[model samples]
Target: MADLKDQRHPQYMGDRQIVTDLLGTTQPSDRNLADLARLCIRYRGFQGARDIQADLLKVLAQWHLTEEQLYAKTREIHTTAKVFATHNDGRDDWA
Candidate 1:
């Protein structure tokens, strides 16, 4: 076991390309992730997905938009998925 300070912080976990490529389906690429997020907002009737898209747009317009934006956006979508998943499972918890 390694000390917390000596352990790897996984700086690459948030990388857009890696997440996108690793998923290799819903998002095989960063651009695809962004596009899918947008499409979810445009088509999906899920409020969570819509909110995720909104958050993504806000982050993107911050002058640092890039492939990373897509990754970040997808994570946001995942949050939505979690929320809906819980709700569907008969739980009303969400913030």
Candidate 2:
């Protein structure tokens, strides 16, 4: 099983790309933002996800994302993660 910090997870990698593209960054990649989104989903079944969500919101504020936009994107990521978790039996299948 891939750990939360493991960006090699397909779901995490996808989310990373989504966030990177959304932020419109042409510079070097930074995993912090994407990692936060990954963690939010990785811990979806636990309170940890909430903590991560709060942290992500704080970071998003700095990025100037409107509340509606943030909510939509965050909700989308969370839903995708939930679906992935459900279908994969709560384990990431990178094999």
Candidate 3:
């Protein structure tokens, strides 16, 4: 993938750096990046584009995200976490 540093947007550039540190040559795509970006915004309640990009970079760098048949799996995970937090009152007692 092209160097994320080459991206114009400040958020995109930061994310690219973080993702590169985290995922190396496997920088995330528009779709996955978008979802991950959105989740960061939602969870952090105004996590500017830079923050979203940073979070996405952390996630990608830490995971072995598959390249084929990509989907919003990260978003789903974020959604599930939100639902779990809402329903379980931020506790693990519900199991």
Highest-scoring model, lDDT: 2
lDDT of 1 by residue, 15-56 (tens): 334334334443144444554454434423433333344444
- TM-score per prediction, in order, is 0.23, 0.29, 0.28
Estimate candidate 2's alpha-carbon lDDT, on a 0 to 1 scale: 0.47
Q: C-alpha displacement of 48 in model 2, angstroms?
A: 4.9
Residue lDDT tens for model 2, 1-95:
85564223335456545554544543312343344445544544543334344544555666766555544666666655542324646665332
Flag regions of model 3 displaced more than 4 Å: 1-7, 24-69, 82-95
Could you tell me which 10 consecutive residues in candidate 2 have the lowest summed lDDT?
Answer: 25-34
TM-score of 2: 0.29
lDDT leaderboard ranking: 2, 3, 1
TM-score of 1: 0.23
* Tens-digit per-residue lDDT, 1-95, candidate 3: 85454223434554445444444435554544444444444334333455545555467445554322123564555555542224545643211
Better of 1 and 3 by TM-score: 3
Give the alpha-carbon lDDT of every model. Answer: 0.43, 0.47, 0.45
